[model samples]
Target chain A: MTEPLATGSTIGILGGGQLGRMLSVAAARLGFRTHIFEPGANPPAGDVAHAVTTAPYEDEAALRAFANACDVVTFEFENVPTAALDLIEAQVAIRPGREALRISQDRLTEKKFLESLGLQVAPFADVPDMDAMTAAVEQIGAPAILKTRRFGYDGKGQARLHKAEDAQTAFADMNGAPAILEGFVDFSHEVSVIAARSPAGDVACFDPGENVHRDGILHTTTVPARLNTSQRMDAVLMAGKILNSLDYVGVLGVELFVTSEGLVVNEIAPRVHNSGHWTQNGCTVDQFEQHIRAIVGWPLGDGSRHTDVVMENLIGADMDRVPEYANDKDVALHLYGKTETKPGRKMGHINRIVR
Target chain B: MTEPLATGSTIGILGGGQLGRMLSVAAARLGFRTHIFEPGANPPAGDVAHAVTTAPYEDEAALRAFANACDVVTFEFENVPTAALDLIEAQVAIRPGREALRISQDRLTEKKFLESLGLQVAPFADVPDMDAMTAAVEQIGAPAILKTRRFGYDGKGQARLHKAEDAQTAFADMNGAPAILEGFVDFSHEVSVIAARSPAGDVACFDPGENVHRDGILHTTTVPARLNTSQRMDAVLMAGKILNSLDYVGVLGVELFVTSEGLVVNEIAPRVHNSGHWTQNGCTVDQFEQHIRAIVGWPLGDGSRHTDVVMENLIGADMDRVPEYANDKDVALHLYGKTETKPGRKMGHINRIVR
Candidate 1:
């Protein structure tokens, strides 16, 4: 096993959004400093990070300097350019490694990997061209989603089809980008398990949290997700299977569909996930800290929940309720330090503990 | 009476110690930025603060720029030079105000102010010179402590007198600095209340925590202090009384001695105190955030703790056990990111919640 990052050593983070901002704070809690690499000027993580390299992913010189300055590197988002990671990896080790990123970066690759592990996944077909799209639509049938294989998030780059006749229009929306057609599952609700793994191969998982989405954005995640003893075990066990398969290091967010037949995988995130925010109030070790620990090679923290929590996101217009929610004694608010409040933008979140 | 700080407003902090570091993190949680003004190089707070001014307090140009950049100013240390505060106050408002500083900067003044409010404090006499020392010795008697009137911390600038004959030597130790001689209070243990107040006259107080000192520095603080329901009420009432009397904005730490007869006010810190570290893990709103909320004109947060916590300071040698303590899943460690560990220096702390 490698030595954990020394106290006061710099850990370079590849993204500077809310997840990176929180990871910086958690790194500080453990006596480590974080350096952020992002293209955007005045990124939210810049406010807390020890240093920031404001250059696009194509800036090899800047990436090299940032990598050289850090003892180890980690990314808050899985979609970071592979070429940038190649440069950083040559200078410093990147936790959660290249394989995890390579698989999760594309929907087709991720689905195939999960299926290879004997895990249940939605019926999916790759669509590289119009001919492939026609074949995929025939296999997946109607009530399916056509999503860009790369860079898809927050319900973006997606087109839903009601029948085979709509496949041509949905494929046209892809703009010639590689795509994946996935059959919709008749699941009751979605729940997610936030799991962590250390380089030493220790695994820890937080309890599943039930998720609700509105306007294609996460609205709330309530703990004590409607799962029975066996389903909870199934969710955790499946998450562990994925982490172990990848030899993963750091936190992973695995969203799953709870169906009467069994649990089917929805998607996976290689870093701290929004669905895991409830851990901040419900458990001793939140997802942010757990990720930092795993990447630094520290022992995985106990993630047992001590209380029930409901995590509500304050997106754009929802920022208006900050004052009203701030008055509630049980609510713990965490804002991202974002300056603008655009519609559907995630501004902040509050974890209200159930007394 | 004044507008609350805007979401992206900058909050200037006057020190770059652990308190400032934690305060910076707290301010970010509320979508506010922080600029730390510290004279030292590579201050611990610099790692997380949005901006840093590394010039001495006497640098008028730097102080002006720092103040001009901030919406409001607050300090982590009470003994900041008066001239620096004078310059900053002209440009921006200072929370907790000058009156609190004036009283807390001098032990004699602090004691006199306590007496003025009908609060119980140890019997004390002032010593400005040899003649005054002799008079104070006669008045306060032996088995007393002689402490400098200003800038004394961590038991420095203090001398203990076993008897009246020892007063001459203790007086010599002061080097002509103004001092206060106080008879020791016969107390079983020490407890402190971490309280907060807003400009609108809103007030809130956390439960008192029992403190243990080692080598004249805080060692550990345990919640659910040995206070009966009445004593608990007295502690909260006294803390609120102090805040209301001063019209205080921001959090204050008040230490009291638990004696059989009654509770005695030991002293008060105008800023966050080391004894209140337990609040980080035990309460929804920690003291750092509460201080920010108070200074920003936001409603006072709920300071009520949800569970029992034992906060132990990680001093110089105590850091040797970081890995050991880290292995314990029950301990939530918070390090200050300090590169060096000197004897009696605070490196970090941990809050162990009782299951």
Candidate 2:
């Protein structure tokens, strides 16, 4: 077998948002260099990385240069343009390969993939056209959500059809973009399982985190999620099944709906997830470091929890409450260093570790 | 009050060693830019910093350019030439001011300063010449250690004169460099208290870590040291007295000897220290971040421990055990991206957090 990249090797990151920023920090801790390829004038990750490429993703020459400079390329977000991945994959290795991204990009395909693996997922129907939209409404009923098959996040590009009029108008508002209509599941609470798998097929999973949402965004995640041993094990099993199916080489965050019947898979994030922030304080190796290890072909760390932890997100105006947490004996405050605190923005987080 | 430096403000560091490397990573988490200024070609800190200046310490033009670019300045080592500090101090703000450095640079002055603050210190006297050395030996005894007042570290520039025949020869070997004769305290153990003080006079101290030295170099530090509550309290109080007296604005590491009678201050490091490595995995905020907060004028964080921790240094050839650690559970490994590892060099450290 080829020798694994040494600690001083460079890791190329496709995006330079907060997730990339955090991952870059993790790579540096392991004595790995990070080179950021981002289109933005200023990327948070670039502020600390060894090198940065500011050209657009369409700049194939710059993409080649970035790939040539790195040992392996990994992305922060899965919605990265397919062409961008193909360019880097041709020039260098890309972890959590393109197949995983293609499946996760489309809502219908992701749901179907879960079904194929014998996992219970929320019932979803494809809306091919206006007629399909009407048929889906009839089949799924009111109070269901219609979402675009691709490029949607943070409550964007999705509509809740609570009434008959809402269905047709909402469908037209989407301008007939290919979409999926999901029937609402009666979930008592939402939880997520963060699992990592190394190239050698070694798998490690963190304790499931019970998540609370605000305005369709995660607000807090409490570890040792209020679930029985069986339920927790079920959540982790679903994540491992997904990772193995995808041949995943990094951390995957699997969101689940805890229904009266059993656990139902909601979605899979190919990288670190907001709900897994509790791992930063509760677990031995956090999701950030685990992601680094997986991408760098290193052994996966123990993802077990030593302390019960509650992670509260500092959204927008809530950032002002950071000072109150500073003096709280159990609280660990983390500010994201964002310049503006617009409404609905993630400003920071505070994790409290309970012994 | 003046406005706190903004998130994007640049912090110029005076040394590019491992401490500066870790400090750069910490500053990046807060969205502050870091510029490492050192007189080396490829320092470890350069791997992650926004910018680096490779020029001799006496290069005034380069020093001016670096100071002009940064909003604030801090040093990773006390051995930074006073001329460099003078150049930067004239152009920008320097935290943990010059007086703190002057006191810490000399063992004699540091001991005197510690004793003046009503803190327990090992008996020490200055040996200015052969006559003074004879008198010092008569008073402090033959088993004492004679150390250069300046530029001594990792057991360098110091000699243990165990026999009367070794005293004059060891004293003459110092070449008349100012020296301090310290009466060795036959202590049960060595420990350290890492503390931070904000400009607002707020102080926060991490729990004392019991330390063990191999060949006068720190090999391991265990947190929640085997000390009573009163002993822990005394350690914190002594650190507080030193910081408040110096009006220190960053993290300081105070090494102590736990004697049968009480705690005696061994040495004071006016910067982030090796003994505080456990804080990276044990406490909510690591010592590097604590130093950044104090220097940037932010309030101190909760210094509470989350888990009992053991930090083991990977000195020189011990880095070969990295793969062993990578496969271990619950250990956070950090390796400096240094190109070479000579004997007695600090390559990195691993922190294991145990419940």
DockQ of all candidate complexes: 0.84, 0.61
Residue-level lDDT of model 2, residues B35-89, one tens digit each, is 9998988888987788999999999999999999999999999999989899989
Query: Which parts of model 1 have CA positions greater than 4 angstroms off?
Result: none
Question: Mind sharing the TM-score for model 1?
Answer: 0.99
User: Which model scores highest in lDDT?
Assistant: 1
Where does candidate 2 clash, by residue pair? none
State the TM-score of candidate 2 restricted to chain B. Answer: 0.98
Among all windows of 10 consecutive residues in model 1 chain A, the one with the lowest summed lDDT is A1-10
lDDT, candidate 2, residue A267? Answer: 93
Per-residue error for B53 in candidate 1, Å, reads 0.5
lDDT of 2 by residue, A239-274 (tens): 999999888999999999998899999999888888
Write model 1 residue lDDT over B1-355, tens digit each, in one string. 2988867899999999999999999999989999999999988888888999999999999999999999999999999999999999999999988888998999999999888888899989989888988999889888999999999998899999999999999999999899999999999999999999999998899889999998898999999899999889999898998888888999999999999988899899999989988988888889999999999998888888788999999999788888887789889999999998998899999999887
Which candidate has the top score in DockQ?
A: 1
Tens digit of per-residue lDDT, candidate 1, span A1-355: 3898767889999999999999999999999999999999999999999999999999999999999999989998999998999999998999889999999999999999999999899999999998988899888899899999999989999999998999899999999999999999999999999999999999999999999998788999999899999999999999999999999999999999999999999999998999999998888889999999999888888899987999999999889898887778888889998988999899999999898
